[model samples]
Target: MSKLQKSAWFNLGLITISSLFALLCFTVAASKIEKGFNYINVILCLAMMCIIIPLTLIIAKKKSYEAGFDEREKIINQRATSLSLSGLIITLYFACFIPFVALGGGNIIKVVYLPVIFICTIFTYQLIKSIAIIVQCALEEQNG
Candidate 1:
């Protein structure tokens, strides 16, 4: 497997694990924490972020930028990054409204879950982007 693929799989695996943990935050601790949009308990979500994000950057940097990218492949990566940025932006905007949409003005669980969703969504974006870039580069290489 290529360096890019390794990076993607590493990110996907790490974030998938975290995403499940985040989902569990709702189902497991929803009743345990005091309610009503509490931001304090977002600490667990923060812990996940603090742990996973550095790992992602480290893996991505170690990923072979040595692959000697051509213009088309570079373009593919650029486009993928742009798309990921767009995804995070949209997630940020929409997450802000979660409280307004919940009818009862949301719960602390939902508050906690919002960052989880955003973090997972960003991971999702990065994974898809890297995969798309790898595929596009492979196809371009084969055609030439």
Candidate 2:
């Protein structure tokens, strides 16, 4: 796999694990404790940012920028980025509007959950971007 692919896979794995851990913590707190939302869930969710910081540093250290990318690679990356931006726009649109709609319908949501939604949006954006890159690579490989 290419360096970009490796980075994408690493990010995808990190996000998946972090998300599952947060979900597990939330589920346990809801099941074991009377309160559905608590500090534990918040802590776990926030900890994901911390965890990713180190992983990102490690990936950066391992990556060698000595070898430059070719025009084809640059084109693929540009296309993938554009696709990912479109996906993120859609994700953000729902993230902002859905909450307002729900709130207007008289549904009460905690402020803490808003952070989680934003975090999930970031996660979704990264995952989609990674997938787009991989898919573009595959298509290019198949065609040429």
Candidate 3:
């Protein structure tokens, strides 16, 4: 696989892992609070982000100017983002049902759905990029 493809796959994996962690935190927090913010969960989530940032930085460090990318990568990233955004919009469609926000971290369904939203966004983005790459390869073979 090309470097970009490999990176995309890697990112998909990271998103999955991170999402699982988020879900675990939400669930644990929800169980303890039963519909409220558990300070522990918030802290955990924050810490996770802290950890993720450094890791992302490390990945960026591995790539230099040449590894930066070209038009194809940009297109792939664009499609991936677009797909995730569509999913997000669809997910948010449910928000209209939410009577009031002032959630203050005290809603069972909301807590459960929060991680899910992240999952949907990440998966959609990865899926689009993966599909795009496959289609590109198929077209190249046919044309060649």
Candidate 4:
């Protein structure tokens, strides 16, 4: 596999595992907290998972000066990035408007929901980008 493809796969795996781990931790912690649920704890747990972004970038960075990317790879990357950005926009639109439409203008949303929305946006972007890259690469391989 090409470096970019490998990186995409690594990101997909990292995201999947970290998300599952975070969910498991949250579930266990929530069960144990008898007093009541805490938004801070949930936010902190998600923020901790955000660390994976930098970690993925560091791992995916090219070690040598010559990062062998051809025109096809570049095109694939561009297309995948564009597709992901489009997905991000759609996700944001839904996230922002859905509650507003459902609840009307006078209703208030919790402050804690802001962080949840941000995290969900980030996940949506990454998920779309990774899936796009993988699918595009596979299509190119088949066409060749």
- The number of the candidate with the highest TM-score is 4
Candidate 1 lDDT at 15 equals: 61
Computed on alpha carbons, the lDDT of every model, listed in order, comes to 0.62, 0.68, 0.59, 0.73
**Which prediction has more favorable lDDT, 1 or 2?**
2
lDDT of 4 by residue, 1-144 (tens): 988798788777876666556555545555545457688666756665676566556545633512577888888888988998999999999998999999998999866466456656667777888899899999999999
TM, every model: 0.58, 0.70, 0.57, 0.74
Q: Ten consecutive residues with minimal summed lDDT in candidate 1?
A: 103-112
Off by over 4 Å in 2: 23-46, 55-67, 105-108
Ranking by lDDT: 4, 2, 1, 3
Q: Which ranges in model 4 have alpha carbons more than 4 Å from their true place?
A: 20-66
lDDT of 4: 0.73
Candidate 1 C-alpha lDDT tens digits along 1-144:
555545556666766676666566544445446554466456654665665677567656744673666566567767767877787777666666765576456445446465556656766676666667667657866887
- Report the poorest 10 consecutive residues by lDDT, candidate 2: 58-67
3 or 4, greater by lDDT: 4
Runs in model 1 lying further than 4 Å from the true structure: 25-30, 35-50, 56-70, 97-110
**How much lDDT does candidate 2 score?**
0.68
Tens digits of lDDT, candidate 3, 2-32:
5666766666576567656756765675575
Q: Tens-digit lDDT track for model 2 on 1-144?
A: 676666667777876776666555544544534556667755754565565566457546643641465677677667877887888889888887898787786667765466567557666776886787788878888897
lDDT-better candidate, 1 vs 3:
1
RMSD of each: 5.3, 3.9, 5.7, 4.1
